[model samples]
Target: MPLSSTQPPTSTMELASPMQVLPSELLIEIFVFCTYNDAFFPLTLGSVCKLWRETVEFSPRIWQRISMADEGSIIRSRFLARTWASKSKPLPFDVDINAECADMILPLLAPLLPSISRWRHFTLTGEREEERTLLVSEEPATPCTDLVINFADYDSDDDETEGRATFTRQYPTSDRYTMTVWVHEIPASTILMPLDFTNLTIFECVFTGQHTHPLAVIDFLSVCPQLEAFYFWGWTHEDASLTTAPPTVHLPNLKTMTLKSTCMTRSLLTSIHAPSLTQLYLAHLNVDFQLPPYYSEDGDSEDEANDPSQSPSSDHATGMGLRTFLSRSRPALRVLEMDFSDMRTKDFRFVFSRLDVLEEFLIVASDMSDKVINLLKPYESCDSPVRVRLPNLKKLALYNCQRLSGDAIVEAVSARAEYTDANASSKLQTVSQVEVVDCEGFTSRHGQTLAKTLGNRLRLH
Candidate 1:
């Protein structure tokens, strides 16, 4: 076989690629992403060719991450790791090795002991309790010098820790350390994760498991009394029953919170007392919205989703999750946004009954009716139950709310914006900004009617 006949002309081949034209920097980055999963990536990259071997040897960032998968030959793996790590030179490298593999990987790496203090990430698995840390300073941490630690995947139960990241930091001149733990995939641990939650101010976690439920995340909040912001994500739709569901987290200083994933909002709202919350965002949740970390694409959750009590009227629905949360928290919430949460007609009406201090309200892709719109129309009469609904609402956005009617919109906006009385005027201010996007019932007739009253305040998209 002649070489000329076997290969295509140079012009016909793809240009500026790995073989001959890419810059070394770009090539090294591409290599890092491509080979990060391979345990013995460095050795494999070096064996490819002279150029790659040189590139692998010279690029310290490429050498920074060393993952040693110990098969049968401990000696060979150790020697290869040693040679590969040497290329990192003075750069602090991240290392992952199994202590079960003879447990001698560390001993073999002893030659580099002088640089131990400089190691950025060091993971010794098997018998070793998985912990990766960074010592920040001699002094303690304060609110001014806040230290943020994203402790992802604290449990190696599923062997997903390859992507797990952990780092530590400290500050000087303070007496206490305010810690923040951001967990992904819901790592297993006690309610506190064995850390002091006294100073925890921000709590965020993402999950997809059955070992523990979102109930645990809700329970964890009880300790973080000083939290300012809380973010909970993912789907875990098993029957949520905690071993001891006694404590309800009281976040006195909490200002913002986002509850996403199916059934998550419902689960957490049952046990939270944030009297100072200002903003809240709920996405992909419904009455029985139990996703495994807790969202289901179909929005049809079994067992818990069909409960009538979950969507009862405000006064009668004290046991309702959202109602309970809103009642207990008494959030002077400035912003309330819900997306794909399947909020029922009664549910949102129930929600609005307590949010008299709410300013900005946005509900997207919900199946609400004209009846729900009545909540926006506040009457002067203290006798009216709807009078207390959204008195301070400033901005309203209803997008993809298919079930709402144009008549309802016009009536609601008119009542709130046009309601001017000499005696006992109730609303702090009418809805200044309104955005109604991709709604079926909002026809041009509806627009004309609204534009007459709300010259520029109304927006139809």
Candidate 2:
């Protein structure tokens, strides 16, 4: 019954064959998905066979996305450097320095800086003073296109101020294309470096303490002709501070801008013109204005009016610079979020009139007031509405506001929907949905009322 010697084995008696190997292209594709965290996988693959090591070594796409930290030891680092040099391809790399082992790691990285012209994203973190000195040294590799400098802290005793000052002074002279600098527990004065990023598209500067003259920062921003996004964070005091208004600096290509601190005056906002801005985020601002208490003509009193503390005041208030800013650059704004948690009710109403074409409006307040909610309600009216029109609005979110009743909110939304459907000239009504979040006293009654009013056009979360 055994098969003949010249005959092939019968199908039933045949031995199983190995699966076909994946093509080299497919293996490279899989390697592309691997990140710095999975670097060991590639390293292990390269060591498996001569062909795999050759494939991994010559693939610039593979080495381009590598993290310098992936090489575990000095020997490994040197090996990686040699591999990178042999490939000689521009690599998009991210170098993250391990703060715990920076002293041992930095020297290894020093040699690779010369080839950093390929870098698209670079992040460095270590002991504050040590990392700053290392970064500012004359031997920095060619300035990268996108750079992020981060400071590492252990016990918070590091002299962050001095470190940041040194970095600021050194950074302006570097030929970096785009940069973001983040400093923790450092004052603005520590940023003594000149701002000379003429080709920068995105810039973010964060500090803890108030600057005597924030205009210096503004002056630095003035040099960037192509800057697109700018963010500023800090605290400012009124006394003995340089309050000179910044000259109007036009950011024609700017798409987003954010400012977070205490209250900012109208003059400050008006000074920066971003013709292409689509999104704006303002937080913890104080605007000095207040609303009058409701008084019934019949001598009957509402509970709120009976309490003197409930009456809003605008005496100490200042105007938001948003109004003047929008008057000139209103055509491009599509999304606006303003958090006036520190401002009085009267101030919110004045600023609300400035967001003319807002499609997404998010307002966060400290307390919900009937008057303030009523002031906002007219934007939804099908008939006479507020000065600011949101014809394209699709989503509106109100947070921490206690004054608006759920019923009132639903009614306003319904009116707005009706108005848009009937009056919109384009035949397709723009607004289709609305949302509200984290209102303090919102309940089932409010939810039901809102649903009934908005019908299919509303969602609650």
- TM-score of decoy 1: 0.56
Error of 1 at 172 (Å): 19
The global C-alpha lDDT for each of the candidates, from Candidate 1 onward, is 0.58, 0.51
- By TM-score, the best candidate is 1
Taking the tens digit of each residue's C-alpha lDDT, what string does model 2 give over 337-386?
76753334444454455555667877776454555555544353466543
Query: Model 1, which residues run further than 4 Å from truth?
Result: 1-163, 168-211, 236-238, 241-246, 287-319, 380-388, 420-427
